[model samples]
Target: MIVTRGSRLPLYLAVPVVVLLAALPYLVAPPVTRTLVGLFALVVLASMWNLLAGYGGMISVGQQGFIGIGAYTVLLTDIAGVSPFVGIPFAALVAGLLALPTTALVFRLNGGYFAIGTWVVAEVFRLVTVEFAAVGGGSGASLTGLSALGPTLRGAVTYWCALAAVVLAVGVVFAIMRSRLGLALTAIRDDPTAADSLGVRVTAAKRLVFVVAAAGCGVAGAIIVLDSLRVQPDSIYSVQWSAFMIFMVVIGGIGSIEGPILGAIVFFALQQVLEPYGVWYLVVLGLVAIAAALFARRGLWGLATGGRDVRFLPTGYRVAGSQGGVSGGGSP
Candidate 1:
């Protein structure tokens, strides 16, 4: 049976249920809880990257472009007189919308070129913002008014929102993988030329995933900016965002939903323990990712789980000519 991307349970049921159950922090509300919220946000960003690069075969260095857009979207919307909570979704939408044009330029390249193009695009977006001195320019902008809400409330709100965004992103990806389009995407990712020969529209699938990934990044970016109450072009657009993403996916296990989430948990713990190491933090992260890529080609979970006995994502699939599409059949 060919259980491809198009056969998972509705991600809506899984993602939101987990997110709601994860509301442990709202009750406890501590510095540790806030850190966990922050960790989930990174999980969102990293998972999106893994989905894009791992499953979709699109490694984008410019995911931060959407990140900045999302942050700025929230900032701009708040300026237009909306509450921060409302401003967040609005920002995410705007970032997703902006990705339309950006896609045209970046998709013009391929492979390593494509990755570099994304980085350049991020820099371009950052530079444009910096040039607009009215909005705090190079020094960056602030979310000071959010602070007025009080630390505990602000933290809780942002944390919940982050959790929500992560759920939304994960759900969307899971759904996409289950749709016919996702079937097409899986083929393309595995072998673009071969898939194209078989009539899958590789370019369009890649583009759709890119836009979806961008939209998810927007929510993540907005939540992060809100939490920081500041937005510096350089920092928000830093290549480090890409680095963190690569670290999580590689170490956790690229191309699996569980991988990035697991990777983020490991990453956050490593950060807490190595907080005093300063620059070494980055070095350790790089080493971890590289080691995984070299030794554990399928990722940590792939190693631990040992080849497809379980899929949190149950892709519905069937043998090409079966009487019915079977439930929970795995990759073709």
Candidate 2:
């Protein structure tokens, strides 16, 4: 395994940029900071989804289930007199715990069945949540706990939390990809049967990825409540969140870490520019996703890099003198 000059570039550039972005709330207007909060949330979501489908070879379309769970967990915590801000990590814990039992059920399915089963489980979560009238049931509830803080302070804190979540989400995914577990996941992704035959703990690897991805999505969901100041059944649990994750991952590049970050930026920019067009915004997004799928099979990242195996965050190894490095040696 060898590290290249290009692999170190992102590390050098990321620090100063993260520092600047951390101070953005103080430097920028409320609206800009608010907009960035949304972007950060999207990056978190896309990264988590990418980890699950891109790396684990688990194409789950029901991640919104965990998102809603996280949002509601924050709301519940707030109702119990805890600061909603304090509930963010707790929400992630709850979501991850819930995923444990969920795996017992969904793991039974495979391929497309697994995907649809996950969606059905999410729908179950939504329906069960609707029955609890204490949480506003079919209606929704606004986050009242933040009322104590000044609007500026609240917004700034929320932005910082959202930023922290993005860093954690991407960092966790990157860390996993560089570890022994990453190697197992890559093998599992390429061929689960073969990976299992070769002593890779396929089920365990997939389960870890599933729980981690759920926890990441949980963080994103908690941030969503903080950003919007409300949690609704329809909006929070909407399959549209799943659609957005899929779109961002597919458009950006599915398997690489940088792809989702780049994809999130593209999706955020498009949303900002095209949102005023209302329904057409979705139309444009759908068209763009389709075009990327049809033309840029490897996604925008692959197209931009001319199909070369250029990696800013290399998760795999390069041979002593190989031309394109080892196959499945990059990110999953």
Task: List lDDT for all candidates, in order.
Answer: 0.79, 0.91
Model 2, position 226: C-alpha lDDT score:
94
lDDT of 1: 0.79
The list of candidate 1 runs beyond 4 A from truth reads 1-22, 316-324
**What does candidate 1's lDDT look like per residue over 1-332, in tens digits?**
23444343444456677766467666674586678777877899988898799878988888988898888877776676677678787877887788888889988899999999999988888989888866688888876557568787777777777777777877777667667877887788889999999989888888888888888888888888887888888888888888888888888877777778888888988989887999898788778778887888877777778866456665435555557544544542
Report clash pairs, candidate 2.
316-329
lDDT of 2 by residue, 26-47 (tens): 7989889999999999999999
- Which number leads on lDDT? 2
Candidate 2 lDDT for residue 132: 97
Among these predicted structures, which one has the highest TM-score?
2
Quote each prediction's TM-score: 0.90, 0.95
